[model samples]
Target: MAQFLNKLIPTALAIGTGISLIDSSIYNVDGGQRAVIFDRIAGVKEKVVGEGTHFIIPWLQKPFIFDVRSTPKNIKSETGSKDLQTVNISLRVLFKPEIDKLPWIYSKLGMDYDERVLPSVGNEVLKSVVAQYDAGELITQREAVSREIREALTKRSKEFNLLLDDVSITHLSFSQDFTTAIESKQVAQQEAERSKYIVLKNEQEKKAAIIRAEGESEAAKLIIQAMASGPGFIELRRIEASKEIAETLAKSGKVTYMPNTGNVLMNMNASGK
Candidate 1:
């Protein structure tokens, strides 16, 4: 039992030492990661490597990893419009560190580059763009404003070895009072439009009525002139009316009966000659 114990102890110690050595010497860089090498004696080195396994003298040099994949950052900023109204803006930026300049970025800005730089630069560009337009234009021309901000950020981000994938203005808002004012203006405009429509409709109706009245008056004049041009029209109408009355009386069976005398007599009462 003593002999077995001595051999097993050495074997176990060897296995543990081997594992420790492997753990220190080997390092893996994941996909989409950028790693920079730093030496204990010489300080940070310019050598930068991308994804996969990497080797360096253990305890002499070390690796710092950075994700070069596209990442989104949110920025909430408050600025003023051209009309001096306070505008609150929410924005998103898709960005990544330049792979080739990973070492350079580490040397200058360190790992906190995103926190230190992107917000200030974005806010500056945002304020400048907002200052160029009024509050109303900001809503109407949002796409234009976003495009301008992108162009400006691109130019500035390159200086810091940051590649900007995209810049988007996600939200634009005004104070409660301003929003209420806008709503009131819209309502007033709608009301004015309705009033104008009603006035036009009433005018149209009045014009139509006048046209009908004039048409009736003209027709009456034409009829009177036609009747006047017919000669003996009144007398002809009277004779036709009498004949119609006689026919009506005969048909009614209420015609009066009267005795007819052969000769006319001037009567001398009670005496005949």
Candidate 2:
């Protein structure tokens, strides 16, 4: 009876050990076949499935899951321009690691890609490009500045095993004194433009007035010349004036008498002679 109990105990112990081994070392990678990596290996390579359970080696081969989605990095920097004016700039960058280059990225930049590569490259390129522009140009041509920074960052990303999706400048701020000065200069420029337009308008109006005066003078001279050319012209003009006066009197329904001018002139001449 003691020998039978000893054999049963050994069998129970062996079964328990096998179950522990299977549980610890063998894992299903959400596929048909199970993956069994020994407890002494360095790493395991397998494709992970979505919405399914995955497994890894129990004690040796660790599985590090990385999200294949896009991520963003916010980069803030304070820099100076060529004119020694300080500018504050903030940028948001969207990026992702290439899935095919995951192993290289893990080996080279590790998991903290944002912490290690983003700020460094972002700051360096920002400073380098900003140093070449003055404060006024920086304020006016900010889009160009952002493009240059994006280009520089894109070029530098190859070293860090990153792909730059997009880069945008979110905000830019200048010193209080600089901003006040810029505002004042812009206002002065606008005022100057307004004054120039007013002056041009006045000049144009003056030219028109002069043209009108010249036309009136030319008309008066032509009338005088026509009168001097013929003696009957004055008599004709007086007859026309009499007709206009008669018409006006007729319209007003008033009676007008026409005096005999020839007899009055002959009596005045006889008395004088």
**Candidate topping lDDT:** 1
Worst 10 residues of 2 by lDDT: 31-40
Q: Which stretches of candidate 1 lie above 4 Å from their native place?
A: 7-11, 227-273
Task: Please report how far candidate 2 places residue 271 from its true position, in Å.
Answer: 47
**Candidate No. with top TM-score:** 1
Alpha-carbon shift of residue 155 in model 1 (angstroms): 1.5
CA RMSD of each candidate after superposition: 13.3, 10.8
Which 10 successive residues of model 1 have the least lDDT summed? 262-271
On residues 1-273, what C-alpha lDDT tens digit does candidate 1 reach at each position? 999999999999999998887788878999889899989999888878877887888889889999989999998899999998889998899999998898888889999889988998889888988999999999999999899989998888888888999899899999889999999999999999999999999999999999999999998897677678885665776899988976675565444323364432223332344
TM-score computed on alpha carbons, candidate 2: 0.67
Please provide, for model 2 over 180-265, each residue's C-alpha lDDT reduced to its tens digit, 9 standing for 90 to 100: 99899999999999999999999999999999999999999988998999977789889999889666765552343336754221
C-alpha local distance difference test of each model: 0.87, 0.75
